[model samples]
Target: MTRETLDRQLHHIQDEILLLGSLVEQAMLNAVQSLKNRDRAAAHKIYQADQDINEKRFAIENAILILMATQQPMARDLRMLAAMLEVNTELERMGDYAKGIAKVTQRLGDVEIKIPIQEIEQMASIATSMLHRALGCFISENAMVASQIPAEDDQVDRLYEEIYRQIVHTMIENPDLIDHTNLLLWVAHNLERMADRVTNICERTVFINTGELLEMDTTDDEEELDSE
Candidate 1:
């Protein structure tokens, strides 16, 4: 009920959010490493990291629940708590998406095959940086930076589309590589989704800062950019 208690709760939630961010970064790194070196153990560790994300999500939700029940947070406080809920959910899904990529890596490890890992690594690096920026925007309370996340995600989307085309081409040309190529294609899809979820967190951050949700549309991004 006291201001001190509320501040403490907010601080605790912030810490949880940061920890979630760290888990996300680790997941991306380990997943890419799995693909690069065919490291099954690294993939397994990435999979295991998902548990930490889930636990952090639970902890954040619990904190929010307690704050609402006891602190009676309203107005901006209510907005913050709601955004925190959305942020944690997005982060959880992103973590799962990362695990999905890692799972594909683990599967490829059993077979004696290799695919172009660099494209995926490049995608991962850019997407991870976008996620890192979203995390930074939240911590700095920068609505402008948060709102710009969708534009940053466009890069990842383009890379995903490119990779998808290459994978489909490779599969069509060499039907024997269909299974492996499809696996890599699915991994790119998962990473794209992860980038999307990271963008969602930024939208939530913008909402927290300005009290409005701005949904970004990628459908006409090309035309929109050309006109601009």
Candidate 2:
């Protein structure tokens, strides 16, 4: 392919990645809303949308692979291709987390139990926001913004901790709510994991911009600081 054609294909792949990001964000939102509102139809919708997310991801990956094989991209172009592949995988996994939350919702069924899901909702909010910003950084190739995105994961982690402790206490206080609380905890865990996948996308953004495969292990540093 010509240079212009190659660049156009790369841009197309980037656009598809952004599209997938938006779908995953919607899935996360719907999954959380389904849980919060006890809407089975909404939960099922997320599960169905996950199929589209998976299909789109594979299509983009195949396009990138073909471009790489036929064009023999230079170092910079190769970096972008590699970043796209990694980010595509992360986005797909985030979609899976959303599906996982949907499954939890299905398991909950029509139980009229009222347990506070506000913290899980907060976790989902932060995670989806991180995902949105990460995609923007990816599209803009902004290493600085990408580098800062993982820091927000710290807030998600804290919310996860709070949810975990609260759920455990609730389960302890009311053994009957053990199943309900456990399911909600799993939902929170899925949202937390989705945020972690967004960090992976941010790392890919940094890699594409700087051509450096740096591991942004901020959680370890945060733990140490907490200990100190």
Candidate 3:
């Protein structure tokens, strides 16, 4: 294949990845909103939308595989192709997390409980923003933006901790709310994990630019240090 053709295919892959990101972002936002409004229909819709995200992801991966086999990309170009593959997988998993949140919303449909949702909502917001920024970094091949993206994960972690404590306290005080609160906890956990997946995407950005894979979870490091 000619270099020009390879470049065109790579650009197409980038566009498809961004398209997948947008769909997943919408899924997460809808899931959180559905839980807040107790809107079963909205939650179910997010679940249905995940099917499209999955299909798009498979198509992008197949295109990347074809390029890798036929183009024989070398050095930085090969690193980029590999990063796209990994980022594609991470994006798909992030979509699954969103779907998981939507499922929790469906399960809690009209249960009439007073579980706090603000922190979980905030977590989802930060996660989706991280994903958006990470994708920008991916498209621009900007390692600087990628390096900064993981710091945002720390905010999501703090929100997750707050939500967990609040839910546990509520569950303890009102034993009847245990089941519903547990489901909310699962939703928060899924959002937190999704934020982590965004960090993985950021790592892929750095990998694509610098050809180096770095772990960017400094929040865990600080926690361990404080415990010590």
Stretches of candidate 2 above 4 Å error? 221-228
lDDT of 2 by residue, 125-226 (tens): 899999999899988899898889888888898898888888888888889878877888878788888888888888888888777788885667677689
Compute the lDDT of residue 171 as modeled in candidate 2.
Answer: 82
Residues 134-191 of candidate 1 have per-residue lDDT tens digits of: 8888867788877878787778877887887788788888888788878998888888
User: Total clashing residue pairs per candidate?
Assistant: 0, 0, 0
Top candidate by TM-score: 3
Worst 10 residues of 1 by lDDT: 109-118
Of candidate 2, the 10-residue stretch with the lowest lDDT total is: 111-120
lDDT of 3 by residue, 1-228 (tens): 458999999999999999999999998999889888888898889877999999999999999999999989998889989999999998888888888988888888778787677787788888999999889998899989788988888888789878888888989898997988899888988988888888888888888877788988766667767975
RMSD of 3: 2.0
CA RMSD, predictions in order? 3.3, 2.3, 2.0
